[model samples]
Target: MKPESALVLEELRSKLRPASVAQVGGFRPGADPLTSWFLKGVCLPGEGLPVWKGQPMFPLIQIRTDELPVIPEQLKGIALLVLFHNREHHPFDQPHGEGWLIREYATLEGLELLPELETPYHPFPVRWVSVNDDAPGWEDAWDIIDLSEVNDDTQASDSFFDDFNRYGGTKVGGYPMEIQHSVGIKDFVFQVGSEEKVNWMWADNGIGYFHRSAEGIWQFSCQFY
Candidate 1:
């Protein structure tokens, strides 16, 4: 969408292969020094280029030019800020002074990874969030509960119930709150309130609530007490 972002996306789209995905931390086209930097300076498996473990990444998946529904009509392209950090000390341990380069593009090809990573990770799914054009009325129907009211000791709730349907991006009625379901593209649950004590062990004390739009977008509502 922006002039600088337009240039960056065009450059990447030209160098990418069809149906591939690569990871990068940051991208700057006309920086005086380096053009781009990795997340925590972690590079690809063997390449010497600097990269990071949980850098804000864009998985460029190839598709027919006519099939991408989310590509904005005005912006040249759109880059979603997908953060992949599962490590215990992740979001906090990231390198300092690094921010995601959100951009807009006109087409689907204006994004990519280096040739090496693309060959193996290409043909992957391209999932990004765009505005829901056909959102339902339920968009305004949801609630947020405090975990303090739901005691882990007795696994009891004052008023909140374990209704996974409250959070949806599709048909509704399914929320995976355990690590076991983390293997897929499903929404995982976590305990709300007091981030210091939040852990998988407190499954019974879960209090976060979310809802999904029919257009496959998730909306979350959480209240920590």
Candidate 2:
């Protein structure tokens, strides 16, 4: 009966313990918090709006496997496996059967296969994939990638709500951008468990909360303070 989004968060936190991680800033409540800032660099300049060049919108959680204080039990085995099969094998990319299959799926579908709620009018479709015998460890890989980004030092902009209050904002020396309620950092919540309690209580004070949406996608919402 737990909310699906909370489950996702807990799973990652547990697995990546002792790793210094933080959530990048930029997610404003109702905004698409998970939207990757990397997309800005991908787009050509002068074609669209210049990327938000402000401080990173998200936290920086860098992990050096060699430096971890307490590596996950399963990961140790994985490292050993890589050590034994250095030339032909890779983490999650065994040269043989299902490992290879899952690796291929991860490369081609992992991002799209997030366990999320369905949505309409989104830039991308929200679909959930179950992990069963056929796919044993795929979820773990995604969890690592996601949790590694959560950090205590990352900071978000207070201007998000201000921008929304005004209904728009102009990028520094750039074109004007319209901020909408549906996309602003309001009207959103990140709660956990069957009771659906907010992960970050006092929604107006903390950085934000994250929860699986009614449609199943992992969504982030900012507090109002």
Candidate 3:
């Protein structure tokens, strides 16, 4: 944890009800990986209110990739936006794919809350798309323009959570770098598997890959945008 995050966690303990914190993100089929990617921006107080016991809960919102509003001017040139989620039962391990798909869809739906910045500037647009290992042809892959070069370091710290917490209860600390903006789609691919085996894509830098492992685990991998 970063020094700043520790301070925030301490503060959360002071202000909100006590709750357990669990890691949420992609995991390998059978064994748990050392590090799990997380949803960075969304946070909640108490697990029940959101009806889900996961960290970095995704709020109900609608998103359409084909018709995204103008990138929020504020985040226009930012490098990355990390997102998080709470742990859940292994979907693939279960019998039918229905339960797993529903849960996974909910997580993706919750992602909408993270990009709710002043209109015309969102971190990146994401959606479910087919993916394979061969280098994606233009029509086959999604395009994520790089803005890391244009971002101003001073403004990077300007967080939406600061305002998000004002309406809902606040968490003590902010997002972790691993969950925030550090990891990207590439990292997720290496962690999970490549397109030949996986069935997802890297939208911008975030994880949005989908595939199943030979061991029978239904897997979906992604990082924050």
Candidate 2 overall Cα lDDT vs. reference? 0.21
TM-score (C-alpha) between model 1 and the true structure: 0.24
Question: Candidate 3 on 1-225: residue-level lDDT in tens?
Answer: 344544433333343211111212233322311112221133222222132333323311122212222222222232223322223422232332322221222132223223322222222222222211112111111223222321232232232123222211111111112323332222111122112212222343333333333342334434444
Shift of residue 132 alpha carbon in model 1, Å: 11
What is the descending TM-score order? 1, 3, 2
| Candidate 1 residue lDDT tens string, 97-116 | 22211122243332343332
Q: Please identify model 3 stretches exceeding 4 Å from their true place.
A: 1-50, 54-56, 59-62, 65-84, 87-134, 137-206, 211-218, 222-225
Report lDDT (CA) for all predictions. Answer: 0.25, 0.21, 0.25
Clashes of 3: 23
Q: Write the per-residue lDDT of candidate 2 for residues 61-118, one digit (tens) a residue.
A: 1111222333333233211110011112121312322111111111111122122222
lDDT of 2 at 154: 26
Which is the leading candidate under TM-score? Answer: 1
Poorly placed runs, candidate 2 (over 4 Å):
1-20, 23-206, 213-216
